[model samples]
Target chain A: MAHDAAAGAQPDPSSGGWSREVDLPSERGASRLVMEELLEQLGHHGWEPTDIFGIHLAVEEAIVNAIVHGNKLDPAKTVRVSCAVTPQMARIEITDAGVGFDPAAVPDCTRDERLEVPSGRGVMLMRSFMTTIAYNARGNSVLLEKQRAPHAG
Target chain B: MTAHRRIDTSKVGEVTVVRFIDKKILDEASIQELGAELFGLVEQLNRKSILLNFADVEFLSSAALGKLITLDRKVKTAKGRLKMSNIRPEILEVFQITKLNKVFDIRGDEAEAIAAFQ
Candidate 1:
């Protein structure tokens, strides 16, 4: 299917850099590709390998959350991803269509008892990798940013 | 997004071998289904030793890790063991990032993992 380049669409211009929008099915597997594209774009802008991995992980976690939980994996629905790269950082936004969820409602997975339970660590991992993460007004959209590491050659 | 993939299960003697033939596992439903499958295998075999082979898997997210952790806990409660083998380099990096490599009994191959139980 043709990628939906419209949902949560926005232009991201940073210090004369380029941005692109990707529309993907709200299913599994798509997130990995999306993350790869993000990495490629960031690399084109001179991001280092370590920063590339960090950005890829953060984007994957955010987009996966949107596709699985927000859009419920409905093929009919699409998760929108837009990436903006700047000399200072890379910012990405992913939006889904399902009823919004409160991030505060998610349990802390780092606790001793919950540590071994499978799942609910995506957001935590994103926070750990990215410099900042914020929920849009609707709560179905997430904005993630990772500051370019020092020596991003 | 949470990638979807299937887990193919087979038996080798008293051991239940759960093979992850997909490249990645990221979706919520798939994670839950995987968890259910592992639980069912443990109950059906009444065996605590499981060998999760990830030879085909290239990536794994925290959600996927969660499923493995859940299975680990279930097997431990049943007095069984959970061992993983043939993890790809990229996926192994994920396990290390989460420090799961330290907690999980990871081996180089299925024979070594299964032999550990014997």
Candidate 2:
């Protein structure tokens, strides 16, 4: 599925130093390519390797969640990714045009029984990598942030 | 992005080396395919020593990590070992975060990886 281009327009640059919008299809290949581009852009902004890795994981998890879980891989819908980077932090939001679900409903990956399962680790990994994570009103949008550590901290 | 490539397996004495030339493994479908190939290879080959060369891979996702773990378990069940080499720092950090570093046998290069199987 594809997002309505007009409705999924890029975020305003006034909100942050850098911003971009991408329409991600249900195909894993397309979704992964969008993530790679996002990482490259973030890296060019001087993000550290750790920060880059964190953002990468967060983005991938969010996008995957949106495409697979939120949109249910429906070709008629789209997963939208928006990213904003500032001196203080970088925030990435992924939204899907689908029915929302409760984040608490997700199974814990830390538990031994669920570890071997092929899914359900994305949200946990995203939370671990991000400084803060929150769901939008519709629950289809996830906002992930990574604060730049103070030079001395 | 580098061109997608399949795993190249060759025998180094009794040990088998699986080289991954692709620079990234992010997609679930591809990772699943790779996992299946790895499982098939491990089954077809009776050798117990396996080395996965990742010199070309610059980034790896949790899905890739999961597949590695799955393959590791499969190999272990067959009384074999799975080792990795030439992991990029970025990818290594992902493994370290998940505490997989302690679970997988990782070496710096082909020589060291092969030496471990001896």
- Candidates' lDDT values, in order? 0.76, 0.76
Clash pairs of candidate 2?
Answer: A1-A75, A1-A77, A2-A77
Q: Native-vs-model 1 lDDT?
A: 0.76
So what's the TM-score on candidate 2? Answer: 0.83
The candidate that achieves the highest DockQ relative to the unseen native structure: 2
For each candidate, give its TM-score against the true structure.
Answer: 0.70, 0.83
Q: For model 2, how does the per-residue alpha-carbon lDDT over A4-117 read when each residue is reduced to its tens digit?
A: 333432545674466767777765665664665567767766678778877887788788778888888888788887777766788888889888888988887656665555
The residue-level lDDT of candidate 1 at A26 comes to 74
lDDT of 1 by residue, A34-130 (tens): 6665667788778876667667777888888887789988988888887888767798999888787899889887666766766787887788778
**Per-residue lDDT over B58-116 for candidate 2, one digit per residue giving the tens place of the 0 to 100 score:** 76777777778788888889988889998877777666666567778999999999998
Off by over 4 Å in 1: A1-3, A6-16, A25-33, A46-50, A73-77, A86-88, B1-20, B27-41, B45-47, B53-57, B85-118
Each predicted complex: what DockQ?
0.34, 0.40
